[model samples]
Target: MSAAIWLGRFLFALVWGALLANLVWPFPGKGFALFLILLFVLLAIHLLQLLMFASAYRHFVQWRRGDYWQIVVFGIVGWFAILNAQPQREQELKR
Candidate 1:
């Protein structure tokens, strides 16, 4: 198991835990409509995340390795690992 997979699990667990906590403990003075609005906002944000991940996958394919499914399942963490693994190129000196 790679660090990327572990990190991915941790992030997924963290997000889901937060969501669970919010449901269990409602905000003071906030109504159902606010919750619904927040749900939509969160969904939109998740969609954006997916799009950004997909774009990164396409752009970094040359440098990337391992299972692509890991990228899909692990989300940000997997992508972070792939990006991190890329070697830094030295700049050529101008003559």
Candidate 2:
């Protein structure tokens, strides 16, 4: 993948991490139970973001017939590739 795509993925992870941390880290020492709950919620949000990215890549691969590994290894860039995978006008007219 291109460096720009890799950078985009980094930005995606960074933004999500920052947002989740901002929401969860401000209440330190409230209680052990609350801390554990917040930790679980943060982990869940991270997982959800990953799953959403993977689903988008998978959907695009089906239509574009591109390499699956590109999506699996580079993650969000795969989805971006799909987003920018517009067929040429000549190609579109054939279908």
Candidate 3:
């Protein structure tokens, strides 16, 4: 994996960790509320990305549960990893 992807994954992990921590020990004030709203918005966007990816690749790629989860968590970075991991033939077919 490239440094950029690793960095993106790390930042995503931190965001997810913070959200999990907030769930266990709720933060005080309106700022936290705004954060929750932002988080939900992000989740919605990721879900949409997942759907688009699945629809676009369903025929050529073998879908897996882990792939879905990764895309959901990592968003575009996950898409990048998946595309780059594909064999050259598959990649060409996608064009």
Top-scoring candidate (lDDT): 3
Model 1 misplaced stretches (Cα beyond 4 Å): 1-5, 18-39, 56-59, 62-75, 81-95
Go through the candidates in order and give each one's C-alpha lDDT: 0.57, 0.56, 0.82
Give residue 89's error in model 3 in angstroms.
10
TM-score of each: 0.39, 0.34, 0.80
Better of 1 and 2 by TM-score: 1
Selected candidate, larger TM-score, 1 vs 3? 3
Using TM-score as the measure, the top candidate is 3
Clash pairs detected, candidate 1: none
- Candidate 1, which ten residues in sequence have the lowest lDDT sum? 86-95
Candidate 3: global Cα-lDDT? 0.82
Error of 1 at 14 (Å): 3.1
RMSD for each of the candidates: 8.7, 8.3, 4.1
Per-residue CA lDDT of model 2 for 1-95, tens digit only, reads 45687687687567556545655765446654565675566556545655675576554433444434445433556556655554553367578
Give lDDT tens digits, candidate 1, residues 1-95: 36656767687667555655667886557654576565566556656666677676665544334535445445566566555544431112222
